[model samples]
Structure formats: structure tokens, C-alpha cells
Target: MRTLIVSEFITLDGVVDSPGGGDHPHAGWTFKDVEFDEAAYEIKGREQEEAGCLLLGRQSYDEFAPVWPSMDEFAEYNAMPKYVVSSTLTDPEWTHTTVLRGLDEVAALKESDEPGTILVHASARLAQGLAAAGLVDRYHLLVFPVVLGSGKRLFSSDAAKTRFTLTEHAAYANGVQLTVLDVVR
Candidate 1:
């Protein structure tokens, strides 16, 4: 089966809110105000290139649709195949995107013939749901140097019991740490 990977930018406390920008209550104290380096950008570019498709939650698709479409510079991501998980969303504004009606489609995609890498981005609720269903194969946690006492966590309360094997951990010069974990039995 194709591996389902979750690529998230989180804090030490596992809060994944607004590490990009914004003054959200839990995010205000968690993210560092800094830009990514050439290496980091290249790495992200590689990830985008390797990923055959992206799976997003409702909030993430809504959050990304407005901005990512206008970002002409990052054409790879904009052109990449996107599947969004949402129950209430009847119509999507983004091009080259399909809204997954339910969890069954999500499961079908996981079992599809394509040996594709599916990257689930900034979807706390969906990530939790995927984890509970045992669909996640790997968790790529980019733990930044910050902490919010309370916020939207990467692993929410509804998440199932999951354990990860530490496969790799590396420190970048840009103050971001990369933790590669394989969900194990």
C-alpha cells in the first residue's frame, strides 16, 4: 500500500496552529517570526515533487484555496492533485481539486494502484481521524522552537492510540527540527 504521510509544522507541545503567520491566540506564542532558507525551500520543493497528491481537511482547504491559487511562483503545489475532506462543503473554488465526500473515498485512495505519496497538511481534525483509522504510515513532524500552553494540537483528544518509531531526527540551521517517525505496532 502507498504510505500516507502527515507533514506538519508543530511546536514542542504539538500545536500546529499558525506557524506560518497570524495572531491567533494559541499561535501568538508558538511560532518564530522567521523566513525559510534556500535549503529548506528546496527540501519542500522536493516533497512537493515527490508527492503525487495532497489530502486536506476542510479548514485547511478553505485556508489554502484563497492563497495558494494566487501563489504563481509555487506552480508545483498549485498544479498538484488535491483531495479535500469535507462534509459541509458543497462547492470548491480551487481548480484541479476534488472534494472527498466521505471516509470511504479516503480509504479507496489509500488502496489505489498508484504508488503515490500522499501528504496530509495542516488538518488537525482530519489528521486525528486518519490516525484513528490507522491510515497514517508516517508522521513528519517539524518541531519548531516554541510552546503554546493551549492550542489546536496535532494529536487531538479523539485520536486513537498510536505509537511511532523514531526513524530520524535532524536539526536544521534555521532553528527548525525535523523528526521523521514511522507509525509502528
Candidate 2:
């Protein structure tokens, strides 16, 4: 079976919203303390290399579509097939992009006998639903140093209590914590 992996950049307090520049008051918070180096890019590249496809939410797709295609660093990500979970998105402009209506479609993807991982990036509500449904197989979180107390969190109050076993962890010099976890259910 294919593994559904969630790759998130979260704050120490669990806030996952708008790690990139956006309307969130703590916009670009993830970049505030960390100094990007060769090792950071290597870590990111390794994650992308493990994924055969990119699974994203509507908002994440919308935000990434315009920028990633233009950047050389994200060429591998842009080349991979992308499935965006959304009920409202009809037409997607990105290449090799498909719009999945809901969780049913996501489940279908998980059931497929694909070889590599289905990497989910920066999609909080979708990730929550996937976790609640017990569809997520693994989580790769790059936890930043700062805390944003008021933004949307990775796990909402109403989220199901899903336990995860930490398989590996690495702490970068820039105070970034990289954790690899598997769902314990």
C-alpha cells in the first residue's frame, strides 16, 4: 500500500497556518528564526524525492501554483503529479494537476498500489480530516522555533485524538526540529 505522508512546517505551539507569506498576522513566521543553508535544502529535497505525488488542499494549491512553477528549487515538486482536494475548484492552471472532490477521492488514492509516498504539504483542514479518518500513514513535521498563539493550529480543538510514534528526529542548528512519526492506530 502507498503511504500518505504529511509534511508540515509548524510553530512550537502547533500553529501551521501561513508559514509562507500571507494574510496571517504571523505571516512568514517559519522563516523568522531559521537561516536556510545547504543542509536545510538537502532535508527538503530528500522529502520531495520520497514522494511520487503531491497532495494538497485548495488553498495550498492556489498559493503554490503561481510561485513553485517559477522557482528552480521546486522543479521536482512541480514535475510530480498534484492532486488538490477541493469541492469548489473547477479548473486548475498547474501542469499535471487533478482536483479531488473530497475525502472519498483521497481514500481512493491511498488504496491505490502506487510505489512512492503521497506527500501532503501545508493543508491543515484536509490533514485534520485525513487524520480523523485514519487515512494518514506518516507525518514529517519541521517545527520552527517561534510560537504563534492565535493562528490556526495543526490539530484543532475538535480533532480526533490520534497517537503517533516518533520514528526519528533531528534538530538543526537553526532551531528547526524535524520529526518523522508514524500513526499508532
Candidate 3:
């Protein structure tokens, strides 16, 4: 079975919104509030090296598809198999991209014999659904020090209680911390 890992750049108050500058009022909070540290983002490079595939929700897919393919930093992601969970997306323009209908497809993907991690990045709704369905096996969170107070959050209030064991952790000089946790199943 493959492991599903939800990786996110979150805030101190658990807000996962617009870390990379989107339509949110406090867009680009991740970069603006925290000092830049190369070591803090080492986990991102590690994730690209370790991940076998990438998964995203419709919103995230739409947001990333046009841009990430052109970014040299995301070449690894562009080369890997990308799965977008969407009911309406019929044709995907990105290379090596596949459209998954819903959570059932995600569950089936998890049941496959693939070895490396199925990394989920910035897909809040998909991550929440996967967590609600008990499908996420691990999480890689880069927690920043700022708190926006109001924005889209990674954890949903209606989700069932789940526990995780911290497998790896690191604190950078820039006040950004990296936390890797494995879901206790």
C-alpha cells in the first residue's frame, strides 16, 4: 500500500490559507511574516525527492496547473504523476496528470502497490476529506509564527479525533518549524 502524506505551510493558529499569495486578504503571509531561511525549506526539497506522486483538490489543481509546470523549482512535481480530485475536470492539460473523481479514487490509490509517498500539497479540502476518511498516513507541516486569525484552515471542525506521532521535527533560525508526523492507525 502507498502512504498518503499531506504537506502544508501553516500558520501558528492552524491557518493554511494563501501561503504563496492568493486572493486572500492576508495573502503571502508565509513569506511576509516570517524571515526567509533556506534551511527551513529543506523539507520541501526532501519531499520532492521522496514523493512518488502528487495529489491535489480541484481548487489547488486549477491554481497550480498553469504555473508550477513552468517553475524550475517544481520540476520534480511537474515530472511526477499528478492526480487531481475533481468531479468536473474532464481534460487536464498538464503532462502526466490524471483526474480522480472523488474520495473513492483516492482510497483506491492508497490501496495500490506503489511504494513511495503520495504527497498532498496545499489541498485543504482534499486533505480534510482524506483525514475524515482516515486515509492520510502522514503529515509534513511547516508551521510559521504568524497567525492570520481568519482564513481557510487545514483541520476541519467536524473531523473525527485522530492522533499522530511526531516522527521528525526541526526549528529553523527564521522561526519556521518543520514537523513530520505519522498518523497513529
Candidate 4:
């Protein structure tokens, strides 16, 4: 079975909204910090290389579809198979993109005999759902040293109280903390 991994750029208070600048008031909080080290990039590269597929929510899909396809850094990621869990996205313009409608599809994807990890990036709503449904196998949270007092958070009131086991942790020179945790299933 394939493992579902959630990768997020979050704040000190667990706000995972718009790390790459968006419509939010404090969108570019992550970019303000400039102290990241080579180790951070190494971790990111490892995750990218290990991913068999990319899973995204509608919001993240809309945000990334236009930008990633044209970027050289994301060439390999763009080439990887991608599935977006979106009810509203009727047409997907990105290559190798598929739209999945509900949690059952996600469960099926996880239960399949696919190799490598299924990575979910910056999809807070989808992450919550996956956590609630106990579909997420691991979480790699890159926690920035900033606090966005108001925004969409990673865990909501409706989210299930899921437990996790800390598998790895790393501190970057740029004050970023990479915490890798496994879902205690």
C-alpha cells in the first residue's frame, strides 16, 4: 500500500495558510525569513525524490497549477503523477493531473498497491480531512518562526484528535524547524 505524507509550511501557531504569498493578509510570512541552510533543501529534495505522486486540494491545485509547470526547479515534480481532491475543479490544465471527488477516492488511492509515497503539499483543508479519516501516514511540517494570528489553520475544530509519533526533527540555520512525525495508527 502507498503511504500518504503531508508536507506543510506552517507557522508557530499551526497556521498553514499561504506560505508562498496569497490573498491572506500575512501571506508571505515564510519568505521573510532568510536563514535556511543546505540541510533544509536536502530534506525537501529527499521528499520530492521519494514521492510517487502529488496530491492536492482545490485551493492548492489552483495556486500551483499555473506556477509550477513553468518553473525549472519543479520540472521533476511537474512530471510526476498528480491527483487533486476537488469537487469544483472541472478542468485540470496541468499534465498528468487527475481529479478525485471525495474521501473514498483518497482511501482507494492509499489502499492501492502503488509504490513510493503520496505527498500532499500545502493543502490545509484536505490535510484535515485526511487526518480525520486517518488516511495520513506521516506529516513533515516545516515550522517557520512566525505567527499569523489570523488565517486558515492546519487543524480545525472539526478535526479528529489524532496522535503522532515523532520520527525525526531538524533545525535549520534560518530558524525553520523540520519535524517529521508518523501518524499513530
Candidate 5:
């Protein structure tokens, strides 16, 4: 079975929206508010090295599809097979991209014989759904120090109780933290 991992850049107040530039008022908070630290971002490199495929929500896919393909840092993800969970997205222009109808398809993908990590990037809604459905195997988070008081969060308040064990953690000089948690199942 494949391991499904949700990876995100979040804030102290649990905000996961607009880490990169966006239309939000607090857009670009990640780069603007926090000091840059290469060590804090090492987890990203490790994730790229370990990931077998990419899974994204429609919104995230819309946001990333155009940009990630051209970015050198995201080359691995650009090359890997990508699955976007969306009923509306019929044709994905990104190379090796496929559209999944819903959670059932996602679950089936998890149960498939492909035996490597399915890394989920900036798909907050999809991550929340996957968590609620108990499909997520692990989470890799880089917690930034700044908090945008109002923005979409990674976890929903109505989500059911879930438990996780911290498999790895590290603190960087810029106060950014790396936390890797595995679902307790």
C-alpha cells in the first residue's frame, strides 16, 4: 500500500493560506514575516527525494500547475505523476497529470500496489478530507513563527478527533520548525 503524506507550510495560529504570494491581504507572509533559513527548509528537499507522486486539490492544482512546472526547485514534483481530485478539471495541462473524481478514487489509489509515498502539497481542503476519512498516513509540516489572524487553516474545527505521534522534529535559527508526524493507527 502507498503511504499518503500531507505536507504544508503553516503558521503558529494554524493558518496555511498564502504562504506564497496570493490575493490575500496577508499574502506573502511566509517570506516577508519570517527570516530565511535554509536549514528550516531541508524537509522540503527530503520530501522531494522521498516522494513517489503528487496529489493536489483542485484549487491547489490551479495555483501550482502553472508555476511549479517552471520552477527548478519543484522539478521532481513536476516530473512525478500527479493526481488532482476534482470533478470540474477535465484536462490537466501539467505533464503526467490525472484527475480523480473524489475521495473514493483517492482511497483506491492508496490501496494500489504502487509502494512509495504520495506527497500532498498545499491542498488544505483535500488534506482535511483525507484526515477525516482516515486516509492520511503521515504529515510533514514546517511551522512558521508569524500568524495571520484570519486565513484558511490546515485543519478544520469540526474535524473528528485524531491522534498522531511525532516521528521527527527540529528547530531552525529563524524560528521555523519542522515537524513530522505519523498517524497513530
Candidate 6:
């Protein structure tokens, strides 16, 4: 069966908003303002390659469409199949992109027996929904150090009640920690 993996860069206080510089409530980036570590960037590149399909929320898709397509580094990610869960976005600007209409179809997608990966990038609400529905297979949370106190958080509502078993962990050179978690039922 296909794995629904949620990979997010979170802060020490569980803030996952605007880690990549968005116009939302989180304008502050956890990493350096514009600069990036080559090695770390390569790791992210590898992630996009390993994941067969990209599943995103409309806000994330719209925010990414304008920027990622323009960058030479993100060419692979831009070309991959992108499925956005949106009610307002009828025609997405990105190539190989489609808008998922309802949860019924998502239920089927989650239950499919495909042997590839489907990754959810930065859709906190959708992620929460999927988590509640028990669709997510694995969670990869890349933790950062700085705390924003109050911004966009990955887990709030029922997500706070969600439990996981720490399976694997690795800390990168940039003070970022990669934690692999298995959903505990």
C-alpha cells in the first residue's frame, strides 16, 4: 500500500508556519533569511525525488507555484504530480496539478494499494484531517530550535491528542533534527 508521509520543519515550540517564508501569519523563517546550506538543500532535493507524488493544500500550492517553478533547484519538484485539496482553486497554475474535490476521493487514495509514496508538505489543516482519519502512515518532523511563541502550529486541536512512537532520529549539521515517528493507534 502507498504511504502517506507528512514531512514538516517545525520549531521547538511546534510552530511549522512559514518555515520557507510565506505571507501568512508566519513571516519569520526559522533558518537564515535568504541563504541556505548546500548540503541541507540537497537533502530536501532528495526528499522531493524520493516522494512520487506531492499532496498539498491550496494555500501551500498557490504559495509554492509562484516561487518554486522559478528556481532551478526545484525543477524536479515542480515537474512532479501535485494534488491540491482545494474548494476555491478550480484551475491551478502549476503543470501536472489537480485539485481534489472531496474527502470521499481522498479516502480512496488513502486506501489504494499503490506501491509509491505520497507526501503531504505544508497543509496543517489537511494533515490534521488525514491524521484524524488515520490515513497517515508515517511522520517525519524536522525540528528547529527557535521558538515563535504563537504562529502556525502543526498540532493543536485533536492533533495534540495524537500519539506516536519514535522510531528513528538524526540531527543535521545546521542544528536541525530529523525525527521519524510511527503513528501509535
Best by lDDT: 3
Which ranges of candidate 3 are over 4 A from the true structure?
none
Question: On residues 115-164, what C-alpha lDDT tens digit does candidate 2 reach at each position?
Answer: 67999999898888888888899988888888788777778798877788
Mind sharing the TM-score for model 3? 0.98
Per-residue error for 96 in candidate 6, Å, reads: 0.7
Q: Which 10 residues in a row give candidate 6 its minimum summed lDDT?
A: 33-42
User: What is candidate 1's lDDT per residue for 1-185, written digit by digit as tens?
Assistant: 67899988888888887666554664544234544545544446657877888999998888888999888765877887889998888778888788898778888898997756888988888888888788889988877777776667888865767788998787877777878899996
- Predictions: Cα RMSD each: 2.2, 1.3, 0.8, 1.2, 0.9, 2.4
Which residue pairs show backbone clashes in model 3?
none
Candidate 6 stretches with Cα past 4 Å from truth are: 24-26, 33-43, 113-115
List clash counts for every candidate, in order. 0, 0, 0, 1, 0, 0
Candidate 3: 10-residue stretch with minimal lDDT: 108-117
TM for candidate 1 is 0.88
Model 5 residue-pair collision total:
0
Give the CA lDDT, 0 to 100, for residue 139 in model 5. 93
lDDT string, candidate 6, 1-185, tens digits: 67788888788988788887776465656555323445444446657777777889888887888888889987877888788888899988899898897666677776777545788888887787778777887888878766777777777654546688998777767777778798887
lDDT of 5 by residue, 85-120 (tens): 999999899999999999999999998888569999
Residue 65 in model 6: shift from native, Å?
1.0
Question: What is the per-residue lDDT of model 3 for residues 99-160, given as tens digits with 9 covering 90 to 100?
Answer: 99989999999888886789999988889999999899999999999989988899998878
Weakest 10 consecutive residues of candidate 5 by summed lDDT: 21-30
- Give the better candidate number (3 or 6) by TM-score: 3
What's the TM-score of every candidate structure?
A: 0.88, 0.95, 0.98, 0.95, 0.97, 0.86
Q: Give the Å error, residue 12, model 6.
A: 0.6
TM-score of 2: 0.95
